[model samples]
Target: SVLEGGTWAAGRRAAAERRPGGGPPLTILSDGTVF
Candidate 1:
């Protein structure tokens, strides 16, 4: 069960890496509210 869970987690991480914009980017906000 633990091994299966680990494999699933690893697969998800690999898929995320393959995405075009896989992670957040640097940004600046003049106002405190982002919305």
Candidate 2:
């Protein structure tokens, strides 16, 4: 299922805060996929 807008927005905000420089702010090191 897709994530809700509020949840996704919050995640983006958290990611931005976590990586303010913003090259690739978020990374999910799975087999070969990321959101």
Candidate that would win on lDDT: 2
Q: Per-residue lDDT of 1-35 in model 1, one digit per residue for the tens?
A: 99988976875665555445633322212211122
Tell me model 1's lDDT, rounded to 2 decimals.
0.47
How many steric overlaps are in each model, in order? 0, 0
Q: Which ranges in model 1 have alpha carbons more than 4 Å from their true place?
A: 21-35
Q: Determine which window of 10 residues in candidate 2 has minimal summed lDDT.
A: 25-34
Alpha carbon lDDT of residue 3, candidate 2?
Answer: 64
Best by TM-score: 1
Q: What tens-digit string does per-residue lDDT give for candidate 2 at 1-35?
A: 35676777776666555454543523522212244
Residue pair clashes in candidate 1 = none
Against the true structure, candidate 1 reaches a TM-score of: 0.54
